[model samples]
Target: MSIISLSSGVQNNLSIMPRWPATQVLIDSLAWQKLQAVQASLPGHLGLILTRAYEPRVSELGRARTAFRRAGICLFGLLYRHRKEEIQDIFGSNGHDLDGTHIDVSFSINGQRVRLLPLSVFTPMSWQARRIKKFDEELSMVLAALLAQGFQLHRNATESLQIHCDLKPVL
Candidate 1:
């Protein structure tokens, strides 16, 4: 199905989707997971749709980035937590075994911390991109999702002390 179809499905069902803050749209964890599960692979059109859905206006991203810098909150890239029990606990048993990894944000907001899992799936990690051959594909999808969500890469800020607010590099 198309990304707009997916977006419509998500938008029509607020109960199943994560709520965005009033002022800005934070990517929805469930919708993303559903996308990963339903779409075998992301083509350019789907990728563009995903980007448009979560990407803040350039001005909004700049403002949010500045505010985050002032607040001292850093935007580390996504972290994957594959613990099955933990996933079940947070999302409940949905009839599917739910073996997929949940991507966490590893960042803070307004002085509080939260995990944002961008990819949600029901397949086991072994069958997924963790395999050597599929690793690159998985990595590309994660980076795309992060970038679409407005996380910019900071090449020179590898040192923690040098970072004010930054996204961890893919390297």
Candidate 2:
């Protein structure tokens, strides 16, 4: 488990809030450190799997399913709890919480715990843009898979949706 502490100056400078080049440097440095920690703990079989969407097609779905079968736990940097308005106010943008200048990755604390921590000091906007595209693409695949497996959109359904399949045919 890797822990990072920011310098007092950087931490205290929050009053001015996200001061250009200097703050960006610190953010990038922190991101690099966290990335190293994540790389150190990855399973041999998994290698470095960036959080990206697989295609919705059958072949891509099969490949994705196989990869997931080998994964025990998956941690993502998605900050879904915050509303879009809140994110816009903070970063002057109207997108996901992580679309800000700072890049954050899921930091694993132990075998069972994980937290989202900043990945980079002022990373390039292009990098952020590419990642967000991949993330959204992957989400689309998720929806595709859910619907392919017999799930439907329910506006306010109370009960849970349970899907069962007998593997005899595929086997």
Which candidate should be chosen as best, given TM-score against the real structure? 1
Over the stretch 45-66, how does candidate 1's per-residue lDDT look in tens digits? Answer: 2221121123333555435534
Could you give candidate 2's per-residue lDDT for residues 82-169 as a string of tens digits? Answer: 2323332223211111221122112112222121112331223355455446444433443343334333322211100101111111
Instruction: Looking at model 2, report the run of 10 residues with the lowest lDDT sum.
Output: 158-167
Off by over 4 Å in 2: 1-27, 49-101, 104-171
Which residue pairs in model 2 clash with each other?
24-122, 27-120, 27-121, 28-120, 28-121, 31-119, 31-120, 53-138, 103-119
lDDT of 1 at 161: 11
TM-score of each: 0.23, 0.19
lDDT of 1 at 57: 31
